[model samples]
Target: MYRDNLYRMEVPSTMPAHAFAPRNLNWNVEQGEAQDLAHGLEKSEAQALVFVSHARPDDERTKALFGFLRRASEVADVMIEKKQQSSWDAIIEALTPTLPLTSSRVLEAKMLAQAMTKVIESEDFARAADIAEIGHFSSKNPSSQPNRWKNSGLIFAIPYKGVDLYPLYALELQNGAKPLPIMEKILGVLQEKDDWQKAFWFASPNSYLKSKAPKDLLKSKPQDVLRAAETEAAGVQHG
Candidate 1:
């Protein structure tokens, strides 16, 4: 009797010998004789059906297959993350059906909604309560301080999910939680832009700053970040 490695069981002594033969060797054998052997040695059809129905995958085999699938899934996730924009585009393209002008506009709206959700849920930004905690606003109205900061042009916020979401990195934690000094200057450069636009500008990569987002370099390279913002404002004025 031969053991079937996949299902990890004896394949029944009645199974034809050619069933265990290597594919290449089996191919060279006489077809008629192989058929005769199969007809003579094969088990009853009921028994064969019972064997198939009762077969269970071995535990080790299942684990190995699961491990292989998990590793493949992880690799796919990393690739998708590395090429996020392209991956998103591909997914949208795949999902978007053939449509007229109105339907196409609806798809555009959906894409915009997805973009907004991503920005709102980003770890870089936080709600007023969280910002208050981080900035150490130990008052009854914890949100008021952040709002005051926003009103003063010292920082900007994005309104999402019925609340204002402030950029966490824009606060200088070491300086008594003061808004970063460069914020006002940057906001001055972006004065014409509304809160949402200003928030987008800070998060978007700038060519003048070697493609680093303005918020990322707020502390490490304030001057460069300011220059980038100025360059952007200049282009807008001219354009």
Candidate 2:
């Protein structure tokens, strides 16, 4: 019961992969569920099963979570349920297999960007459009945002502490677009949250102009990031 004293609120907007205070789900925590949880816990099975959380990266809860999972993975074959917190005990038991340590919060985002070779801003779609895609299209041929922005996708949320949170960004596409398993693709992109320029470089290197990063962007200023976005927008050509 690591409940913090401060009040928490959810960001109000349409985010593809929304992160919020962890909301506990009520279920039997029955034997079947435990087995299922254990099965899904196998990290080696998937490239990575990232946990997108709202917990401050430096929070004690983050450390606790990592420690907890590492311990669990070590004893994955054993039924050492008593050591786990009641809430997570159920999740661990329900896991289907041995899992890898999850990359949480921004770390998850950064790793996902590396895996997918793309980036996600974690902003609402509209904000993403504001900072990333610039310019307009003809009404007869209005441009559509990537599919992930238009819909939600495969994602998992773990308790950052007492709160429920998830990845901020959903996925869209690569520069050299190829279809991904819809859910994995979503998971892949969600992993890329908040590293838009790097994502672009990785996913579709050809889409970016490497010659001159806006000075402000190189300095990691917000306005400069927007400048880079506009530059990207102006450069997009529908062939």
Candidate 3:
């Protein structure tokens, strides 16, 4: 006696004739429909649903999308914060100490100093110091240190909210409270210009100096730096 065995097929048919063809997704048609629906929507209804998408935080696409959406929303108070200092602002800040003593100059110098401190901290060039510390380092009386450095042209005694701050890199400790020789020469070259212009010249990188910043090169290559400064000063004179 033989028993007939029966089993239900679990697998789907693999025959091409039995397969269903995939329908092509028409993105253009769907997008048009979405636009139509959005257009037909009331302002309140549209505002009720915000379709937000995000890209990488630093991506240009994300920034563009954010700008487009921000403009589309007619947002007047939305502020886009700048993460890096502009070249012009950096120059102005560097020159702040050179301006005539004034209340506004003090405030600007303070803000600029704070900004520069952040940058210098990152670069590890030199630590920024308040008047007292700079005075201690230079072995001068704390109260009159700013005046001493300013008179000697050793440092820019940047006035900040009724106080003075100095960038430590400006002075050469190895040589008895002396200003960097190059700085003195550069200052002489820049004597005719306003503090802002002089500051810009010192801080900005020069192609002639192989893109080295004048302030940074003051110690190692004073002569070459001084020549570059003279060239710049001449250009300013002739122009």
Candidate 4:
């Protein structure tokens, strides 16, 4: 009973002066200095790390804590509820842009976007709707067929301006508009890579193929294209 009582007793709120005072003082001073350095707006660039001292108990408590933070600083609040299932949801919610982008960064982005738009909107790339209309895919949801093909790795799509556009060369126009015969093998070589990387490999000139872009020879010389993809994949692995 005595041992059980001792086990249940609360820890002392204070420690001996010699045991932790020096360490506590040092830690407190360092933490204060870090906060001062991070939050000093007079610096050319400053960033701060803020956190709640304890786990919030409820939605109202969470909201109240964030509200206090917003009042204290120029912060954009993202109130996460207990019921949310994914960590990504909270992160995405926190990152959702609350203001329009401005300055030279915005100008550079706009220029890049215009250049990409010119290429992505060309005849080389077409949306699912266009392919469905031209290829006559036998499905109720014609627009979804290309996405299904992309998911299966029979073909890939590039994302531009919030829309996915498929390369027209990925399909065979002569034979029931099925996926290009060699694409599966090429995609296999570049497996686990993102769409943009795969797209870049197709668009960029390859020295292995005598400086010809892979897409240009995909129909005329599929075996050569496959070799080029293999060589690129090998280089990426080794280099």
Candidate 5:
């Protein structure tokens, strides 16, 4: 009886046009629940189907997700191809001698400078009032006025483009516009280097300070940061 009924049933393609027409499907899938089971194959498929039913072609979130997935797939392909062809150690051994130490340092410096430029452009720097803004001129004389702040070592200026930007982190404002005790010590250690180099020293992550940048640790652990700066200075001096 079941086989006879099945034989009598009409095929989907042969059904009425309205019956075969695509129907709007809606699924009330919660984002948090879907995310929780995102890694599970069955749950992932269910989530995908839900998205497919609701997601429009022009959806920005869907576009970004697909774009990211595409890039990730491309990177995976490149990595897999490289792994199959040659090991990283073998490749490094082949290319290492061709690249000189000076060349490597120059490349590293260029990359670091580019990274620093991004940070500076993003306005992530601490607010430090300039000489004119601070209004602390020693005399009416223009020449001597600029020298007052420069000579005191109270502020270190980083030269970006044509302007000099001073980081305010070196100052202890709570103690009445005075320089932090360790600031002078750090400045002394980094005195021989240029302004940008000094900025990099303070801003770059320090291995001695457990990967925290010196500028960040200056307030909490100034002595330890200063010690690290001194060690770096010693290396620079000896090297």
Candidate 6:
């Protein structure tokens, strides 16, 4: 009975640090910083947002692959969310007369992708192979809002190597890198054969194999170039 009582007394000592409230810790640490921020605003002090990060300094391979991509995506997502939550009146007030809207949207998407890639491949992120995507996106018949604003991003179940890279590489090789679009048959013919277009599918291996295609055309982004031969063929035939 004495030993049992002693064991019970020791149990609480081994409790994990996380058993305490998380918010309290954050509140204590962040309090000074928040106060400084307010003081800076009052003084109209020059300031730059130093990116405090959770990622470690040593992460390399994962950073290269997913660091920039993840971070950029996160940052962009926050901005997008804020914009979405804004009232229409507030949005109208914030709009710039010289907005090159499409370009901005594209930039945001690119940044998000870059951040993600860095995060995934950075050496500090040691679990390079184990790293999995949390979210993702696809652009088949993408709406302007979702494409520009970005819907939820892709969530990879596994690190992209054997399973993901192989198929992508195989597709690249089969397509002769001209991407998935083989326009030779279609420049004019695709416009004529609307029904024939249905037969072509980018996901089909048979549709992609070819040689002597433009390097630029072959490797053009995946979402695009997926059905170039088919779409153009329909365009020409349908037109």
- Best-fitting candidate, scored by lDDT: 1
Per residue, candidate 6 scores C-alpha lDDT tens digits across 1-239 of 11110000001113235322221111111112333444444553333233232334334543453445444543553564455556555766778476566988999889756754553443322211122121112233322222222122211111333322211211223322211233332323333432112222222233343422222343554323435556545555667
Note the residue pairs that clash in candidate 5: none
Which scores better on lDDT, 4 or 5?
A: 4
Indicate whether candidate 3 or candidate 4 has the larger TM-score.
Answer: 4
Q: What are the models' TM-scores?
A: 0.54, 0.16, 0.41, 0.52, 0.45, 0.14
The better-scoring model by TM-score among 2 and 5 is 5
Task: For candidate 1, write residues 52-86 as lDDT tens digits.
Answer: 11123344554565456445544553564457667
lDDT score of residue 134 within candidate 4: 78
Ranked by TM-score from best down, the candidates are 1, 4, 5, 3, 2, 6
From the highest lDDT down, the ranking of the candidates is 1, 4, 5, 3, 2, 6
Residues 1-239, candidate 2: write the lDDT tens digits: 33222211112233335222232322111111223344444432323323333455457775576556555544542343333346576776888687666657668778755654322232222332331333232333322333333334342232323432222222223332212234333334334343343334323423233554332132234343344445554454321
The better candidate by lDDT, 1 or 4, is 1
Q: In angstroms, what RMSD does candidate 5 have relative to the true structure? A: 20.9
**lDDT of each residue in 1-239, candidate 3, tens digit only:** 22221111111223234222332221111111233345444332212223333333445664575556545443321221121235446777988876476898899999877665554443323223343463355434454655665677755544434555454555676544545656766777777875435555566789879998777777788888889978987998999
Error of 4 at 13 (Å): 25
90-113 per-residue lDDT for model 4 (tens digits)? 778899978877798899888767
Worst 10 residues of 3 by lDDT: 3-12
What range of 10 consecutive residues in model 1 has the weakest lDDT sum?
Answer: 24-33
Question: What is the Cα-based lDDT of residue 92 in candidate 4?
Answer: 82
Point to the candidate with the largest TM-score. 1
Supply candidate 5's per-residue lDDT for 166: 62
